[model samples]
Target: MSDALEKAEQAAREAATDTAAVQIALAALELAKAAQQQPAPQHHQCDHQHKPRRSAGEWIGIACAVCVGGAGIAFASLALAILGGTAAIVVLVLRSMWTDVQKRR
Candidate 1:
């Protein structure tokens, strides 16, 4: 009778342990499913607002004005100053356009 009682108690302990393990596994599985169903967090751009870049023509006009002003101040002859200023403006415009084209590629 003592031997039979000991065997029964040992079996009960093993059954309790197995039941606890199964319950833990089920809880972990439920947590995993919930995590999977949740949507991932979305990231946004920095504080700076998105602004359109200056058009090529606008950039050219601005560059030309600056160049002409600087050339007029530096040169003695108006004709020579104007010519140099125009050349500088053309170069700036061409360079700007080239860069824009390269960026598109």
Candidate 2:
């Protein structure tokens, strides 16, 4: 009689384990369905507003700035030319001094 009871208890334990596995599989299926039903995330776009055209006064200001910039660039070129000429003159004078010293030697 004891042996029969032990067998029955073991069978009950196995059935319980099988029921838990079924419950877990059902829960997983439910999760998969919920995931598939979810809506895709939407991207929000900003409405681009065009900037107004520049006024006549702004145009005149831009032109003045361009003229001033051109004048500044011209003056910088003239300064660089003057510096190059001065450097050439100094080099020539030094070369002449060196030749004179060699002749005296």
Candidate 3:
């Protein structure tokens, strides 16, 4: 009975070791196959489409500059008109004052 028991124990240990080795080999094979199946990485390419890049921010800045320049011109013209009107009023007041003083003399 002892001999039978020892033989059974040895057989189970051998089977377990064999199973472990088979699983290791299968895992290594699957890893190798996966590495082979992967596609190679391509180099970064600069195409014609990527060369002429104009972002929306740049366009917005250009438009803003144009609008501000137009506004500045309009404001300057308005300021000039106001100055001219003030000057005309001053000249008229001075002429009337001088004429009245001459008539009283």
Assess each prediction's global lDDT (C-alpha) against the native.
Answer: 0.95, 0.98, 0.97
Instruction: Compose the digit string of candidate 2's lDDT tens values, residues 26-104.
Output: 9999999999899988798669977999999999999999999999999999999999999999999999999999999
Candidate 2 ranges with C-alpha deviation above 4 Å:
1-46
Model 1 weakest lDDT span, ten residues long: 72-81
Error of 2 at 38 (Å): 38
lDDT of 1 by residue, 1-105 (tens): 999999999999999999999999999999999999999998975998879999999999999999998988677577787899999999999999999999999
**Candidate 1 regions with alpha-carbon error over 4 angstroms:** 45-105
Candidate 2's TM-score: 0.53
**Prediction 1 global C-alpha lDDT:** 0.95
* Alpha-carbon shift of residue 60 in model 1 (angstroms): 17
Which candidate number maximizes lDDT? 2
What is the Å distance of residue 5 in model 1 from its true position?
0.8
Q: What ordering of candidates by lDDT runs from best to worst?
A: 2, 3, 1
Q: Is candidate 2 or candidate 3 better by TM-score?
A: 2
